[model samples]
Target: MMILSWRRRRGGHRTSKPAFVEDNPGMDLAIPTHFLCPISLDLMKDPVTLSTGITYDRESIEKWIEAGNEICPVTNQVLENFDQIPNHAIRRMIQDWCVENCARGMERIPTPRIPVAPRDVLEICSKIMTATQRGDHKKCMELVEKIKRWGRESERNKKCIIENGSGCVLSALFESFSSISIQEHEYLLGETLSLLIWMFPLGSEGQSKLGTAPSLRCMAWFLKERNISSCQNVILVLKELFSSDEKHVNAFAEIEGVEEDLVKIVKEQTCPKSTKASLMVIFHLISSSTSSEKTISIFLELGLVSLVLEILAGPERSMSEKALRILDSICNWEQGIKKASDNALTMPVLVKKILRVSNLATDFSVSAILKLCKSQEGGDHQQVEALQLGGFHKLLVLLQVGCGEKTKEKVTELLKLLNQQRGRLDCFDSSMDFKYLKRPSL
Candidate 1:
């Protein structure tokens, strides 16, 4: 299976062919690629397109038009709108090549059409990171297997070099340790955050060798320790990270050292369960700072959403409230509101989730969202609807019935804001609030 991950634009955008593909076949392909498809001669996968802009499924595309499409196989430029299919001769040639290369073909051909050296292999792995950061999962999978192979070999070599004392070979691995640490000190966060897309399953091994795997949380600490608070870059990284991986829905996900840090912060007794400080760390990195997609995606990809939901669902009211605020933070990251628009997430669900979280919130906790919903004075209807969907009436009831001055204050603020949209309340008995409701219309 060809894992051809790529970053498509917001809509119908195409990425340029990777530079590795044009150089030598070895760098772009793990196995012999030349014999696969003569044109691009690379791995072929989903949405198999033709010169005429027609897309076929993997099997159908394989059956009808082997050797893949003649044009750039990555985007299916030829089949963009499907005016026509490729010439029969071209399809036949590709079909013949597929038959020859099929794992169960009649003739077993060994040795790749192209031979790959370690350098070429390394280059390919780096490109996988690039593709992943750009939200290109299809392209990332193209080299996954080869990436695993490289890791296994690199692992073996790292052990060998450490044991043999080959001129302190680790130091010469790349120009990084000093630079990596210096980069840490300078507080220069990543703009792309795409590295995390490749760090999964196989891409992380190269951190010691390729310098591609970036430590986002650790880097955040490094920045925080230095008071380097420019957050625009970190947020970009987080958004890109969320755009790629869906693994961040849990609290104790095992992601290198960073996961350990988050867990440590969450579990500490001395630390506020609300995790005000740590939340400040991640929130600053993701919502305020600029980072690569890898960092941004870590929030979404590493079970961060589910984790947030769980935290908001926890028994500790303040902590739960903080978690909901964090969810809102994730939603509000760089162009994140637009992200929610593009993804198929429902506003009602988010509201219901907010209500679920709010039900357990402390006096001031639930009010945070009321303040947020009222931010910018009702210019955004989606936010208002989210609060209402989360059972805004029930929340107001909770605030009303609860016998606390803080609760009253929050309700007062809520009513102040609600008055803006109160005109939509025509069905209500205008005296409803003045009657059975707690604290009486004020």
Candidate 2:
């Protein structure tokens, strides 16, 4: 009754290898072939039967189902049901076989835990919702803690919870906090939002429920909390909500103190992770053309330009890239250009990042400089500053070494602007040495 494992050959089939007993000096033990799973070609630790009347290891079959395959892997037939019924007979036989081969390296396979069913999840969610509706705050929080425990148990359980409408349930939990003072249930709200973040891709309905004015305000309030995890959860949920819908983005923009709060997150949050999230939220906010003016004005008024320049001066590539992207977005407007040029470090940092970080960073840096240099107000002064900041050398090097096509075009244009102002600046010795400054062949 010993179970043998099969090994695949270079050809396309499997061959079984029997375990040999070292204590018996070359005695080969034949294992029952039926106890082996076709998918793994190994001894089935927990055998389960599919709708096709084919049995495979539970782990292998569960993975196949999780991969979105509905057909039986062996029978190639459409599966009527995905439920895996454990084959106790085969499992017991395998256990007995392992015991008989104890003298060898064979070890007994432990019993597998029962999988969580959809009904069980639904029952738990119903209890939580019931408690919530009854204003049983203590009971509701306790149930939520249990749900979080279940979700953290395994990916399978989390997927089951989401599939069973747990996202909507959690969204309702967030909404439930609206009428009640957040201070009373701040910890509960944080836990609920944290769970919702884990169950991402929350449908439009769920997002809409959570995106209500009250919910948005509650999330904003979380940003001002002393708890770092709560703040992180609020930003992450907002990131998803705003990223999915423009309406949510606009709605978020309208929230009082959101801009200042986000900037505060960027400047003061002790967590680097939270700061990065804040930068992304700002990137999304300013990237939208509709909110460009207001977003840019708020960022500049809050000294965002100085903060970004400081980030660029640091060693983190991702942070620098995101900062440059935000700068590029903000600089699309006239006011943004003026603000960037007004900052002393803006031009110098833009030039320093030209060929330094990445292609994306280089493109954004060039675009920001190009925007600033093309403006009519103080455009000439900015061009002169660019040359003095060694921007002329950087652009020349970029063109000579080559860069993205669009970036090359921008550099050519900026170089032309500098060439026109060459006489006003002493940084460029002679225009002849700048002969290569001419537009490159498209």
| Model 2: lDDT of residue 83 | 86
Residue 422 in candidate 2 has what lDDT? 74
Our tally of clashes for model 1 stands at: 60
Q: lDDT by residue for model 1 over 1-442, one digit each (tens)?
A: 3423222112211224434434433432223332234333332322233554444433335443435544434554544432233344434444555455333222222222222344564566466556544534345444544444443454433333223322112212211332344343232122112222223222223323222233443344433332323232332333333333323212112334454344344444243522544554455445443444555666565555555555554565456555655656666544434443333343443444433444434333444445445555333564455444534564556564663676567666665655566556444334435225443222
Report the lDDT tens digits of candidate 2 across residue range 320-368.
8889998998788788788888888888899878878877888999999
CA lDDT, every model vs. true structure? 0.41, 0.80
> For residue 209, what is the lDDT in candidate 2?
80
Give the lowest summed-lDDT range of ten residues in model 2.
6-15
Give me the candidate number with maximum lDDT. Answer: 2
